[model samples]
Target: MDTDRVRLCFYRLLQLFSTCAAFSLVASLGTGMGAVSHWSMFIWCFCFVITLITFIVQLGEYQPSLPFSGKSFLFTYACLATAFCLSASIMYAITYIQFLPHGPFRDQAAAAAAFSCIACVLYALEGAFLWLLFPETTFYFATIHGLFKLLETSVACIIFAFISNTSLHQHQPALVWCVAVYSICFTLGAVAMLLKLVKFESRLHTFFPHFLLGQTMLSVLLYASALVLWPLYQFNEEFGGQPQRSSDVSCSDELPSTLCIWDQKLTVAILTAINLLIHVADMAYWIHFIFIRSRASAITGL
Candidate 1:
């Protein structure tokens, strides 16, 4: 198979894994499953950003834009690839601990853990692919992404464990802790992207647009999953025991646990369905794109 084709598959599959993980995360977060808050709250924000970028890229293809640059696209790709890998690894650990043969979400946790692992592998491959394509700068993106994610995931685990304690009253100033950590991570991700957005806009198409054609579709899936999670609550039962939302990860006086019940199992299901569709669409698009390009080159060579 062509390198492009392989990348197509890797990305689409990563989308599926990412989406399913998001679903479980959404449901888990919304309902505050197990000892942790739902994974959706903090994560959905990142997913939304990813979706927006994907949409912008899609629009750029049809309508052309001053922002189209090979360097920029490569940078965007690197940042996302970094996030995806980190999310996969952390999510795997979180779900594993959440279920742990001793928790109520065992089945869901197991499935999610598997997806996270696979997604992690794909992103690692993606990082490698990009390294080969642009060996000089891959390290910068990877390191930045890794540092951010390491902080995000590690803090999340600590925060989740802290909140999961049934004796929430003991963890004084819980609200402050959660808010501070989440704010820091959010700021880091945003600053990194803002810097990149500026860079992409400045540079022309130093990168081949065709290289990423049909590629941004998977991000759409993530966007869809993120959107659907906001109002869709099918897993309300899991919300009872969790700490109050300091909006998402911490407890506050404003929103009591009594009001935190939001089940998004249906949202998870929808994301899974979308993942299947993404996989199929990716396969179809890349095959067509590659074959057509190959044929054109063959004819042109004569």
Candidate 2:
């Protein structure tokens, strides 16, 4: 089979899996019996499909007559694969440690075990890829991304460890912590990259295609919104945890009890809206890159 054909196959498979997962998640929300369990299973299946497709695509033989060498293409593939695996690993880990055990399904324990094992393998592969493809010019950006991954992976590991020791699953604190750290790191790294792009804007036309530049800008916007949304969600969660007022309290003495709920709901709604926008922008950029832009520059010819 040709490389392009294989790539297309992988892309189609990912699209299908993503669609099914979205549908299953939405459906699970309306079910009363083991909703979390069913949702977790769907997500696990989604991650496994994405990870396997990504790994196969990364390993496919592609011979391009571009200015860049094959090693550059391989490095880019590795970076993308790492990113996919990181996301999959985090989702799998959370589902296993926090959702699966309390699930009513008979196979929940087995599913959790499988997810844990997969997460370990993905973590190892992500680290190896990072070490192999560390860029010289983008050292700061790479370092920040690496640190963020480390923190995220650590949080997953700690949550698993806690679950093992206590035989109880609780992930709110870890989720809040991971999201907070990821938001800060993403904001700083995106800002730094944006500044670099601005400094080199005069030469952008010479070095990059217009479509690619636009796609990069869209990616920046997506990351920025994600960074903002993470903190907003965390703040909402924190505030939502505040103590409730007693009904016996006098009206004059009671501060507006509804205010807290309204504030939390407003923050959550805003974050959700921004997140949806980010996803839309991400999809648009992905389509532009896949169809219109040349693949040569996409993999920075190290």
Best by TM-score: 1
Q: For residues 12-78, what per-residue lDDT tens digits would candidate 2 score against the true structure?
A: 4553444344334434434432322343444445555655554464456434433334333333333
Candidate 2 local lDDT, residue 228? 54
lDDT of 1 by residue, 205-275 (tens): 42322333333333334434433332232223243222222334322334333222222222223433443
Clashing pairs in 2: none
- What's the TM-score of every candidate structure? 0.44, 0.33
Q: What C-alpha lDDT does candidate 2 achieve relative to the native structure?
A: 0.40
Clashes in candidate 1: how many?
Answer: 11
Give the runs in model 2 whose Cα sits over 4 Å from its true position: 1-60, 63-110, 116-120, 126-141, 145-302
Q: Over all chains combined, what TM-score does candidate 2 have?
A: 0.33
